[model samples]
Target: MSFTRCSLFSRQSSSDHSPSLLFTGLRWTFGAIALSLGAIAAVNTIITARTPPMGPRLNGLFGRYPARYGDLAYAIGGEGPPIVLVHSLDPGQSSASWRAVFDLLADDFTVYAFDWQGYGLSDPNPEGLNAREFGAQLRDFIRDIVGTKATVIAHGSAAPLVLEAAESGQINGLILVCPDGSAPDEPRQTERAEFLAQKEISDRLLEFPIIGTAVLNWWRSKPNLEREAHEFALWDKSQVENEARLWHVAAHQKGAQRAQKALLKGRFAAPWRELWKNSSTPALLVWGRHARGFESASEWGALRPDASLQVVENALLMPQLDAPQEFAGFVSEWVKKHTE
Candidate 1:
């Protein structure tokens, strides 16, 4: 999924960029801006939802299949060894998160990307599919439809699933982009402990009514939501669509909300120290320099002889979106080298 800042309102203005003023009033200003932006986005979504569908036909890219979670939808294309791309649980991104890379690679490889249940066009998963459950579905997807061991690529929250799937011998190759739950080199034990504790607290906060409404509103608010939708479509001015915006609105739908809640509760993390200690799949770890997590890509690389890490300068969370051509070139060359 793409990265977009949450908006909130504040009394401060952008003109107050003075270092001293920022030092003294940064917190309040940031909060206010966030609030205002969030409110704007939420209102825009409400209005947009009420209007008729305004974008071009999405075409017949969606396919339906039944899984334990209910009906699931996917879009497949391209022409090489099957590559299954899994977008993260990031709030607003769906298959479009891989749009840039998808278009570029589809010319060379058979690309299969899907909307995870409760996230996009796919049916909701009330039980909230965790990595374990996701891995089971992945096994079925590869063995049944792809018809061969495929290369698995994931961004953000799905890294754990890709890792677990590879370790379990479900796939032959793995790629993790801006993965969450990553630890930095020389990580302070306190940081790790705090992360563990904060995850639970954050989950709970998102579930609370007043705070949750504020958070969701902020997430859906105007310039913020617009930017989020734009980012998912790779910030390309031409690619922006009403459906992308609608997807953002649909994200707050009952089913999607349940999935969001489930995600914050640690449905994606798995203790994998031992698993990494003896894995054989070749992995390529790509992270954005601006991404908060995954600071120690090199350290992770050191853990596995075949794992390589590439840090894309200035890319926030979705490097594929942030630097499409570069990522496409890398993926093209990488798959060629590793896929035999």
Candidate 2:
């Protein structure tokens, strides 16, 4: 009789057993809650990773809307003719790239150093990035802020943009430092075409969301920044630690990747030689002794024979940062000579 009763209890309908049913339901509920919490945590982490806070730095004043590309961050000082300094379009570069030489030039001329759109303290563009759009923004900035024909000093990628503006008669004079264009080896038309094609293919990969973000982040990482600062930007290794910190901070700013991605996709490509060949504006070409790209200063000089050339010894791409005194003296003397 006892064995029969035990067997009957075990065979009873599972649904009729409250304790067992309750335990199963509780297990499922707890699992769902845990998964939900984990999902929320994951989303929060991604958000935090993507949006980094910008630190406090001097950007001077903001030039609003009608200037194009929303707003521009610019600083202006001194009492002489306006000299607008356009910074390179490198991933971690900004107007602050000229910080070492800003005050020096300001003492002699009305110096204007500005962050291009999607850089430094300037507003980022949600639409998209293109050279034409940047040229328009620069034209508007010159018209609205400088309020007169100003001398434009452009570096690296900014060189082509300044050349375009000069072609449109927006600037009185032009100075290019380590401008990007056709490489010396790629001087032939077919070679230039091949270079552009290769660049387009490489740059297109950076437009993908996951891959592009990862690539850009890696490129701007602390280690890479330190190496680049020491090898490419500054002549002295001792200066890299501090500059790398600043560069890392700048690279993490929200929307910083947008400009880089756009640039990588060939949005800034132009016929640099054609622009240089046609520009009648008095120009100065400042090259670092160790600068890359141009194989011969004489070749670049021949492009604009009327333009003056100055080479800063023991410097890499950025003489303004590496040799500020010599760079500023040359620029000051050039400005004085040309503006007169």
Candidate 3:
């Protein structure tokens, strides 16, 4: 009886201790995870602080104007009818998107290209910027700098901003390449939060601070950029090796995450369908046949009977980079037709 009692007491003691041990283990596990994240953030912050800027510069920086919101940087050269090129908005996109078309159009028309606020050469916007702010910047550029009617060309998500800014007679001609119509056309409201939860994990990570900057740097790393350029936007990724290198430089600029955070937060995209449909400005719409997530040219074309649509066979999202000569030709011919 004494031996059995001793054995039962021992069993009860171990059972009592097991819960405490498990609770201790859980605390240690959570503590380790928190420590690891903090260490990673600290390392990344140091690396970011030490890293110097990089570039394959856009050649000419026409000016930097202090606007009401963020500062501006634009390049201008060649002389004729004014033409403005607005680069697509991606996490790290800059005016580098226009290297080919900018030079080509410069020969026949005075060409302008700008780094959007929070991107290359332009002042970074740390408070975060949205399309409404971007539209204001573009409008001021047209009203103050261009100082006259001009033809505006925009790529991808930059279209809505341009479309909204091209107030009656401010832009006589508009050319949009692969403009995003994926957002709902039901309401014209921008700055919507409807798309926030739908973003990918990588994009959502861009909203955080040190960790976000680290994630943006990783995304902008040369190899990942090459893969993104290869698989989605560019038809000839090998040809844009220099552009990819330049883009890597632009993407790593300090405070680049501000606009990117806005981009991922659904601030840069909205339903441009009705806005696009309502525009009276003479327009040319182009799409790459291989583009992954956009509607067919025919679908977008149905909205505007007066507009011309072309689906280029050997291009993807960025025909400007892929087929510069051909894209410039399209613009040149179309503008001439409108001018004549």
Candidate 4:
């Protein structure tokens, strides 16, 4: 009887402790992984910073301009009401996204497109890109560089930055292509705080050094870039055929991971739809005809009855890239209406 009681008690105690032991084991395992990645990330970043970049450095249509985070690479052309083209987010993309339509629009408007810091042709910042800083940069660019209130055409992740930049009041109008979300009129501060908190933890880990950078390089690798292009970015894969190879070069630049790390930390994100809704500035929302599972322009119209929405034919993810002429026409007409 005594032995039986002792055995039963021992079994119960072991069972009770197993779950906590498992959790501790998992925490240690992840900690080891974090350390490994951090070491590798630091080495990679240092090597990149020390050496000159290899093969075909990124170039802008015009040249670099003095901007907040670093010297921003920009291109300006044409002779009418000024328009600024802000590229999609991430280290992989830059003003190059506008190449297809830039010249077309330049015919009528003084079109300007530039690489934000930590991106193509722009100097890399060790601290990485932050959404608010980008917003402030855009604001300054418009005030000092652009020199006038103009139409801002932004795509994908860049849309939110545009909204941020618009807060300072240099914007006469906006065109958001395939914007990320429909923001609520009221700020969802609680949800944002929680989300940011979660990301901050990860961001801290990524800010370490080598391992984090390695992970980012893995993500920005050519294969991954191609995969994203086919799976989500482009509705038509052929458009990527003649694409510039500079992004591959750009991704490996020293401190490239800083931008990726900041992005992962959620520093570059914003409530774009909400910002657009509240801006009271004249605005247009555009979508690719085949924008896979996104809110339809009509659905968006119903949500913001005051706003205008348009759909370009035979495009997805990137309406302006796939259908530049149609996208250009939208810009020309909208600017005409708002400015006239």
Candidate 5:
């Protein structure tokens, strides 16, 4: 009706459409939420897919309190006497750390390789990450799982647990490989304390929410894995190329960051030297000639003359991985001599 044009019939400006703007804003917000949820779902799916299967590998869970993250994953194979191969407490390490020597040892004695709690396929417990607890776990594992007094071969920081088990008469024999300690006169105590302090700080930082994930992703990057493999694990770069993928995958497993955080915080470290000194069990100390720490094997030998010392030539920290045949040979002979 042109007779009197109503105000409602007037042309409205773009600014007048507040309701439309609000609707559009709501749609965008919901879209963003959906996209975020989808991304999270995808990531979870990938993690689930990448998780390794236990398979028919004779792996089993053992511990007294299974519900309290006391379930430990272990693999057993071969025949004859039992020999448990315990891996180091280094970041990203697990039962897989002994893969290079597992089959070789399995050829002779019944070999057991296990992931410490929170590492590899084992359960995680933030509160149970300490040396005494770990030592108890080993003792229980031997008593319950192996069903016999088994010989223990422990590496790096894992040395303490075996040593403690030996002290408690839970194990038949003990072997320490590139253990974490220095000679009495060496000025390593202060250095070790400072290093542990830094590691504790780093571990705490890695426990943060988003930042922890980001930092761990960076820490487990391909380049870093390659560097660690060559500089620390292996003498040859070709060996790194072969094992880097396995290490990378192991480092990315669920709870791996938490495990590494627990270890780096020195939770598994104890008065290991005192334990070693007091241990009555027959022990074999296997050292890599080029290993950085424990340079004074001769000095330690003087203190614990009962323990035998053997240095693997041309090997760094991991003689088992670098020179599996020789390491296995030494182990076989030592086990035979001691077990007899």
Candidate 6:
């Protein structure tokens, strides 16, 4: 589907500028940004098509879901309270995001997790999908598909959206895995700046139509994609196979890009604060010992009334992948105690 090119969305300016002039200027800027993104998309597609596929297994998992805006392709399995898992920024994090938890909880709660807009089998958002918007979409999907009052389990940047949904009082419980929005206790000056830079790039790219498309397309390549996966899994650069998995997600799903842009721009911050302040849902926050969000969870939980924090003994960003059995058992027990 072709989308109209436009500049990054602009909040109304308080300037005394005339409406017509403002509108006209904004339109031109938007158009230029859109064209740029489109050109990038074309180039990315060309490069991706030339690259090899990850063979049959990866292709099979690349699927779609028919939602109001469009179809969202995701991975679904297991059965009980509906548990939707939202993955983090790491590539190849689709079904893999829920692997540890799914195996453990499938028998008890009906598990339903999907790659947000662009990561898994979900389609790309040519029109741009914001984090705040995705949160609303996810809430609606949970109410409509999984039924309201179900549990939400999310990780990384997706935690903000889930938090928003829970704050709406619709979610029964929440499980956050290495959530990203909290203010860390020991901030790294260089690392924080690097994250800021990447986010800026993601935000700028989203506005440029061709560039957005190209990035997604290149993202779908085996080598390029694998690199993403390795980074997400926090592995060494030599993990070619892992990187491919990450790329496969970008190639087939569009939501990932939209979600990425939203997170980068601090879109989820408001909702995150709202949920933490107002909600009564039982929350279990799990973080890796070495994860960026680890300290944030501990400090945040200490101040909250109904929240619990768990720091894995020795792990990275993905505790489930690093310590599956233990992670699964912890989650299962927590869910049982809270739900019952």
Q: Number of clashes in every candidate structure?
A: 22, 0, 0, 10, 0, 41
Candidate 6's residue-wise lDDT over 243-338, tens digit each? 465446444443455655444445545446656666678888888777655667755685575788777865767777677788878887888888
Off by over 4 Å in 5: 1-68, 182-204
**Candidate maximizing TM-score:** 3
Distance from true location, Cα of 260 in model 2, Å: 0.4
Compose the digit string of candidate 5's lDDT tens values, residues 101-156: 88888888988887778776687756546777788778887877788888999988
Best by lDDT: 2
Tens digits of per-residue lDDT, candidate 2, 234-321, equal 7776788988888887877877778877676667766678888888888899888887765656776898899898888888888888
**Clash number for candidate 3:** 0
Name model 6 segments beyond 4 Å from true: 1-46, 51-65, 89-92, 126-128, 182-206, 209-244, 248-269
| Residue range 18-43, candidate 1, lDDT tens digits | 55555657878889977976775676
Model 1 segments more than 4 A misplaced: 1-60, 182-215, 219-247
Q: What is the TM-score of each candidate against the true structure?
A: 0.70, 0.78, 0.83, 0.77, 0.75, 0.68
Root-mean-square deviation of Cα positions for candidate 6 versus the true structure, in angstroms: 12.3
Q: Candidate 2, residue 210: CA error in Å? A: 2.3
**Which structure is stronger by lDDT: 5 or 6?**
5
Q: Which stretches of model 4 miss by more than 4 angstroms?
A: 1-61, 126-129, 181-200, 241-246, 296-303
Query: In candidate 5, what residue range of length 10 has the lowest lDDT sum?
Result: 55-64
Q: Per-residue error at 334 for model 4, in Å? A: 2.2
Quote the lDDT for 147 in model 5. Answer: 80
